[model samples]
Target: MTNQNILAVDDATDRPRISVIGTGYLGATHAAAMAEMGFDVVGVDQDPRKVEALSAGRVPFFEPGLPELIEKHVATGRLRFTTDIAEATAVSDVHFICVGTPQQATSFAANLSYVEDATAAVAKNLTHPGLIVGKSTVPVGTAARLRLLVARHVPAGVGVELIWNPEFLREGKAVDDTLSPDRIVLGGASPAAEATMRELYALPIAAGAPVITCDLPTAELVKVSANAFLATKISFINAIAEVCEAAGADVSVLADALGHDVRIGRQFLNAGLGFGGGCLPKDIRALMHRSKELGAHQAAGLMQQVDEINMAQRQSVIDKTVVAAGGSVLNKRIGVLGVAFKPFTDDVRDSPALNVAAALHLRGAQVTVHDPEANGTARANFPTLSYASNPLDAAIGASALLVLTEWPELVDVSPESLGEIVENRVVIDARNCLDPERWAAAGWRVVSLGKETVVPAPAVRVAALV
Candidate 1:
């Protein structure tokens, strides 16, 4: 008969009625995940086409297990899609705002126009007041501001709680990470709101995932701090790589040795091409920008080095290319493999691989690039770069091959076949993702970061006795 019991009704009603807003990569994936966990989820989006696609068991992008998950849920009547915001608000007690908040131009602050619009829409149509949780990454003070807005607009004496539960899903492994998260974080002003969160993620928590609870500010910080730490880890290795390059040492070996220590167990210490994708690079810069505006100039200054190191790593790749291409890229045929910043994701935002590709083209090299999942997105960004269907096709008649992104396909490429296609067998492994011995044995000259060029053993000739 009370509001708490009203929200609790979904528990006994055979699968909780759930609604996820803004069904892009994050939302669509989360919606599918809730359904997989036996929740009756209604996925809502402003775009009728996207809603229709999900309703008909279609996924807009290329996630490995997403389409099948959506299909499985839709068949069981436990999942559905909707373009009507009010209908979703009416049926679901928990509405997740999963919209994007990209950085605003002319400043370092996050652009929350989309977040505001999505939040206001959810506020206007409240059937029975429950919880409105934010899963979007945003500026530190956003949840508090949104909480105030919800209170101002909600019906008199109606109980609607706002919670901040930031998402930590990596682009490629979103589904697995969602279903079996290493940790669950919930932040809100009310204990009741936190209880609902615990219930929602109860399965993961019971399965031995650590659940951390705090107020709004601490939860907002956990997301940004985690990103900042990852950025620092990457830059730290790249900085060492610079020293190795100057001192004639192998960074790959140094990384391996250093990684053996328990403190630095080598998750993000890749020595080549730096960090990128949808997060990392942008998030750190934005956090620094926000700190400076908050008068924390000293903290902002430290991140300046992190930013400098990542940017410099990209330039280092370009510099290596110029040196490898006979001291210039002037009219040389250059091949670029893997345009996605990292492997297994189609997102190309601030991607170092594409940046290198564009830079190589600017330096007058006839650049040809290829990636399995990212070529379409890459072409949209850099239409001038000649894109090929596969890695071998990209190297056809090229003077130099630049391994920019570390897709697994690049490893299995036959070095002998590549030798026959190029003007000379030379490769710059910017990612250090290839084996030096294999490529060298195929008579291809292999150049890589923080190490000397390797010379393969010559083929033994059998002398004929006449």
Candidate 2:
């Protein structure tokens, strides 16, 4: 009654039929990617609306390249959506639990209700042998706990094995990350489970993605620890940016110089409005909470500072905006560029950009928010703030433009065009995304965090010698 035996009984085809439970950002993308990998994928969700959207070859969420992939697979009949978990379990040999582990309403701990419920649903319907893979980010001991839960709920004749395969997908680059993952980590107790995971990811493996096999706890720790490190890296640079502001040093220049050192490669060295969105902030807090529960108070203390520093970044932006508006933004129109946490996705969960816009609006500033893909979600999140159709619309008649999120369109925005629309030729690069020299050349008074305002002197007027 091993996982291999279960697969043998259920899947007669060359490729295993995969069921991805929970069709949010993670599950939907995983299902489509698995389908593209040649497995007939059934995406399961409790929400009928989401299923209908996917069934119609439309991605409910905004992810670059994911819609096309889902459409391609759905058109070819390789991918399908379902609201019935039992129906999905009946057909699939492997179930990937991609449910969300959001932060608890009253605590810093991760709420694993979705993960637990998904596990129970799949386990209850496992009439045949199946491999259950946990792709959700959970507490370190969750996989072990879920293994026991699955064992208890699985039917008498059915064989079920649990494996922890934490997903490391960034919101914007999920498709590329899945199709050609940097590395794949599989944590399982049995050889059958590991072998099955390896076989499942054979395409990515053959494409040169490294596979790391480990114990359940280690695998769970890897995901949280990676996020924690990234959060810390971001906060570390932001902390330095704070010093740079006080000491009159340029953080961008410092980061560029620091990036040259192979030991301190600058991946998360951005010193902007700080890290937010779904993963970094919540994952770090959950890690800290879990560490405290495990009696590691010192480690938790360090992460607490990281969280504090990240939060401080948003306040710093607000303070700077207030100063830019002559100590009050009351009745002043402020343009906000980019409301999504980052570019190419519409996720605004705890987005710093939206938070700043909301804060400004609360302080009586007329905030007009703009984002390439996230305006809809941002508007939903912050109804008080007015949304614009485009960057120029956001900047039109505004006193000062605030570049909050580093969308590529916002990054490459022409200051001249923006200046022509705005009442004041003032631009605040809160995200440090725009080139200060370019804005200066375009007759803008450019302001950036952690850098002195050095407007290039208007090209020296040369009087013709008659």
Candidate 3:
């Protein structure tokens, strides 16, 4: 659909009209969820390809339940995608800035250019009184600064309010999170703006999600703080995983015991290749940079180590892979399963699994990689590595296999079937998701990150089975 065909505001309903700027993962999900919440929603983006795909009821990337929901809303005329910012502002009373804040190429600071531009565009095109909500992850004080920027550009005598409403979305489970968020936060909202937001979020609010109101800085800090804490939890367990290897103890059992404590939950305690994705890695670094800028030295130091330990996990996997290959990985046919950061999504930004695969490829390993959903995205990111259609295809004629992401398919593969294909029976369980005994019984040697590999059985036994 052309910009001219975009839906105009429908004032028949008492609910506040809505517009979402920057239709990336966060924006698209928000727009669709808003539509599902019974609001007339317009999703705006500068990329025509994204707009066209979304308008055609197709999501550009993989997100569970998003494409079907977007298609449902589009068919009902409650949702539309557009490239024109002015049209979006002309049609909605509440505009959400959902742009990306990626880490800068040279610095730990986040790149706020897109957020600033989206704020400016929405502010400049306001033909009526409206609220501009920031749903992007950004440094504290960004909303206050954008408030002044919005004030300067808004039409004379036309009211515009800026508030920070940070989003907390897990990539694969975005639909459920958006529809029934754990909590809803609104920062620096005027009574009127808060009421409008309440009206906009009536569905999720009715679904038992608590709403938290705070000052702009606290609201901004909430998102990055949560990410930093989770990253710390992940790195904490991974750090223990290294010690587990040294002491020949099982990190998983230790994690389970620790998780029994009332305070320390089981979530994010998995000992594996450390956390990496579009959010955790960058958000923690951005938080650290901002903390240091504000003279908060301790937080800055803690986050720095969290980042260091997380990156070290990748090298740990590479070293283990080399050892699993019987010393040097040079000229060895290595199979890698699951390259996405985690499972059930195609996002590969700063993925630890992909990082390990690429690092091994650079070290002269003939790497073959597979992922149920991320093969296309991963291939684009690392073109030199071979892509396979399935797990068996990836493992064929391989000397060693590595399970990176905890995709269920890769975790539940038939050991006997896989053992039939590989030249050697060595398997690196980087995610520690496999049944070691089952693989060992199938005559495959299991090399996990933290757990000690059992002594190899008689060569005659391994050869006779497979």
For all candidates in order, the CA lDDT equals 0.84, 0.89, 0.91
The C-alpha RMSD of each candidate to the native structure, in angstroms, is 2.6, 1.9, 4.4
Worst 10 residues of 3 by lDDT: 1-10
Candidate 2, 379: how far from true, in Å?
1.1
Candidate 1 accuracy as TM-score: 0.94
lDDT, candidate 3, 1-466, per-residue tens: 0112122234534567899998999999999999998989999999999999999999999999999999999999999999999999987888999999999999999999999999999888987777889999999989878888887787776677888899999999999999999999999887777877888888889989999999999999999999999999999999998899999999889999999998998989998899999999999999999999999999999999999999999999899888888898899999999999999899999999999999999999999999999999999999999999999999998989999999998999998999899989998898889999888888988888778885346666445665
Give candidate 1 misplaced runs (Cα > 4 Å). Answer: 1-15, 455-466
- Worst 10 contiguous positions by lDDT, candidate 2: 1-10
User: Candidate 1's residue-wise lDDT over 378-439, tens digit each?
Assistant: 99999999999988889988888988888788867888888888876788888888999999
Query: Candidate 1, 441: how far from true, in Å?
Result: 1.4
Clashing pairs in 3: none
Give the per-residue Cα lDDT of candidate 1 at 87.
92
Ranking of all candidate structures by their TM-score, best first? 2, 3, 1
Deviation of model 3 at 345, angstroms = 0.5
